[model samples]
Target: MTVRPTDRLDETVGIDTSRPHPARMYDWYLGGKDNYPVDAEMGRQMLALDPRVPVMARVNRAFAHRATRWLTEHGVRQFLDIGTGIPTEPNLHQVAQAVAPDARVVYCDNDPVVPARAAALLRGTPQGATEYLLADVREPDVIIEGARQVLDLTRPVALSLVALLHLVPDEDGAHELVDGLLSQLPTGSYLMMTHATADFTPEESTAAVERLTAAGSTVALRSRTGFARFFAGLDLVEPGVAVVDRWHPELGEPVPGRDDGTIPGYGAVGRKP
Candidate 1:
């Protein structure tokens, strides 16, 4: 059943054009036209340091797609994707429902601009459902409640935090927030994540984080061990917490430039036992 879009908030959340937002900046990196000049400027700065910034974005996006397909093929029919950025084609629901036509998806993002383009998010198969929630990942309670409206909490759901948690610093209770949200899911539910890491290119990654922080954007590129802690209680899928591109590359197309330089991120999927 197609879900009729609902207006949850009465006021339109204003988009801040002065500073760079991760979503818009990411869009800029992906060569999408939905970003502002300010976002492009920051994206340019990121590219200057690592010319493969766009490749990294694509690699991260590809992982999200493959993970969704993997989960749906494994019998999952509901998804809760938080930290979902601007609507990109072949979105989580589109990928999941392509395999499981009756899949239900709820996408949440803190960016105010996301809601304005939420229509792109709602366009899923007629047999499937997609809904966007204007909420922050930091507030897991609010996100869970919003997701509950469309997804059955008793059934297994794949929670995707792809290419997003790195934008949230540990000081913001990032780990705790993930745990809180996962606690709401039933056993057999899965945690699919891709986190940027400084493990490979420490100098460049550190400098990138500093530059983003100066512009009011934060990037917390965690170490391999730090990223794994996010799935402590869960059983990790095979190829435990490898580099983003290295994890299940056989499952998806190889990202160009992925091997030429360091991808600078880790990706993994874990199941709640």
Candidate 2:
């Protein structure tokens, strides 16, 4: 179920062409035309550092699909997804609604371009509700308030950070932010995440981060142990914190370029005890 962007897209939604955005750059990685030349240029620079950047994007997305499916299959019917990029095929609502038609989803992102594309995200099943929030993850209160309008915080909700945290630096209190959000949910709620790491290729990863930072994009590559600490108190699922492709492989099709080398990212799902 591929989602089409709104025809009413306004390019002036605070979009900055002078610097690259992680969302638009991600769109480029997925081969979508939503990105600008600046984004493409930065993406090419990252590619030069590691030719598998695009492949890593696909692998990370595939991990999201698998984790969402796993949660919905386990009886989670509501979702609070922060940092949702351009609405790609089988958006969170679509994936959840496929398993449970009444699933409700609230997507939040600070990206100016994301709200402009909310039309596609809103096209969920009649039995469910899908809403997008034009807010940043740093403002947890704002995101939670917006999400409360669409989801029942009293019930179990999957808080999907996905690939968003690596962009948030420790100086920003990344762990504190996660804790603040989790505090608002019930005991049965879950956290689904994937983040880029320097554990595998420290040298190239450092250079890539420097380049992206020079381009005005914030990048904070963490260690494998650092990634594991995000799920500190929660109970991890089986085969914990493996490379994106190695987690629950039976849930999705194979992504290309995975066998070449370490994918430089990690994905995992953890439940609040």
Note the Cα lDDT for every prediction shown: 0.86, 0.86
Models 1 onward score TM values of 0.96, 0.94
Tens-digit lDDT track of model 2 for 1-273: 223332223344667799899999999999888889999999999899988999988888889889989999999999999989887886788889999999988877777777677664458888888777777899999888878877889899999998999999989999999999999999999999999999889999999989988887787888889999899999999889898788998998888766768788999999998
The TM-score that candidate 1 achieves is: 0.96
For model 1, residues 35-127, the per-residue Cα lDDT tens digits are 999999988898899888899899999999988888899999999988888887778888888898999998888887776686544587888
Residue pairs clashing, model 2: none
Off by over 4 Å in 1: none
Candidate 2 lDDT for residue 19: 88
Tell me the RMSD of model 2 versus the true structure: 3.1
Candidate 2 weakest ten by summed lDDT: 1-10
